[model samples]
Target: MYQVRVLVLCGAHPLYTNWTAPRSTFTSLLPRAKDRHWSLLLHQGLPLNNMAIFAKAPTTCVSFLLPGPVIIQTDEASSEVLYPNYQNCWSLREKTRGRKKAAILQPGISKDLEKVKAGVGINSSDEVDFFVLLDNVAAEQVHSLLSCPALKRFAQMIEQRAVDTALYMLQEEDREGIQMAVGPFLHLLEGNLLKAADPTTPSGKTRKLYLYATHDVTLMPILMALGIFDHKWPPFAADLTMELYQHQESKEWFVQLYYHGEEQVPRGCPDKLCPLDKFLNTMSLYAVSPEKYHMLCSQAQTMELGE
Candidate 1:
């Protein structure tokens, strides 16, 4: 059998049924795994849940939501510490073009979006208005709307486009976009891959699985950084898994990425199973070293906030 290490990036709050339901099903399948770690790393806004599967599992204190380390100016001089600044490339995107309707969307799509907004009692003409309205829509109301096949299809399309707008704003060409969006997390993921490939490391020898629980905002940027985002709203419990394998004979290492359950061929890879060196090189484009990450974040100026 191929020796493998698994890493799962979960992007959803467990409080929602949508997140909990699929999580339950996924956990049930691995009831007997011997070497696994489930880290409930979360943003400050999310309430921590220590019960359930995490009751006995250790958790990471690091919040992977930000780029890590903040530089502050004191009365005496300047200092750098671990903290969050809301002025990241991802957050600054709100001040850019994400909130406005893109010129490229077809007129028919615009009409459909307007109809979706109206159905949900949204009076605003903003392109992203429906997302705000839909968040508060009662589950029963959504169920009733989805009961009709046409309405269900329309709902899917609108939701996907709304999420796509958010993704589009994080394009690599944007100022420090990929760096501010996923620098720390990308660095950590690269470290994991490195450790998994080495047999003498503690994590490589003992840990077989690693899980990170986060939100859609964090997940989308990661997907975009990896060049695998499908431009769809990540439904409840959406996850990305990275599997690293070592051949038994030649002992060569390879990587495979999966979104939800479907295998993905990440950009810069020639095949579904990518050699470790090639995968690392592709990811290096988005990865930032600790010193550089802190410097870039310290230089950021806050932009206007919005959806």
Candidate 2:
């Protein structure tokens, strides 16, 4: 059996689900393209050939969600419409077309949060906005935990139930919320993305920092796949990071993962950092494709029907 570095044995990944192509078919040596930023390692069916792809491939990947999006989802605003002037308020951080945003929200909305603490609600304890209040309370509790000496242990205990529940829901073959969201995200790391760890040729190179702003719907599955999530749901503002490092002498790659600035150990690596080649070999199976993830998801429904 092929061993995975971090993920539990759920099943084959989307790319490997129905792949029957003979390994020998792709044996030709194809020259690298000059213009593109990243090339698939398996391009032209050859082995790892390019430096750019090797650079951007992060050794780490995982998930964690925040209260803001969760509150938005659960606050009966399924449509995702925000307050009138707030529609275009948030910025994408990255600038394009030589233009920058007016301003971007910091890691957490400390200023806005202070406003809430001052009673933006109809009343300090209104039930109509009670759910949002619950969110604020939970956020404050986590903030308090940061300074407590036993913060790590307390945080773990708090998150165990969330981790268990996320894992349980994702394991259900028929359920798509967590499972479907998970596969593509992992593929973005292992299957397609290139690493910037290795020094590149003189001109064309990929950037070292790749930043994405997304909600918790995308975070939980990744956490489950990595088997490293343990927290009482993501708080007001959370960060899940997958950092890659390269050895100066050996040229070997390593993956270090972090959540909200706290380092996490993936199950695959005993010391909590996975070897790059080993990590990719294990995760390659789950790499992206059109329909395989949904197909894998059907394993649940099929079992229930006994067909």
- Candidate 1 — which residues are off by over 4 angstroms? 1-115, 125-128, 134-154, 202-205, 302-307
Residue 18 lDDT, candidate 2, scale 0-100: 19
Give each prediction's root-mean-square deviation over alpha carbons: 11.1, 20.6
lDDT per model vs. reference: 0.55, 0.40
Would you give me the overall lDDT of model 2? 0.40
Among these predicted structures, which one has the highest TM-score? 1
Best by lDDT: 1
Model 2, 1-307: lDDT tens digits are: 2322232112112212112231121222223333121122122112111111211211222232322322211443212211111122111111111121111122223233333434443433332222233333343342332233332323443344333433443442323333344454566666323445445533356544444444553455456556665634554335566777877899877888787567887656666677876556544543433355545445555665796
Candidate 1 lDDT over 196-229, as tens digits, reads: 7877887537455666655556666677777787
Model 1 C-alpha lDDT versus the unseen true structure: 0.55
For all candidates, the clash counts are: 0, 11
Model 1: lDDT of residue 172: 43
The collision pairs in model 1 are: none
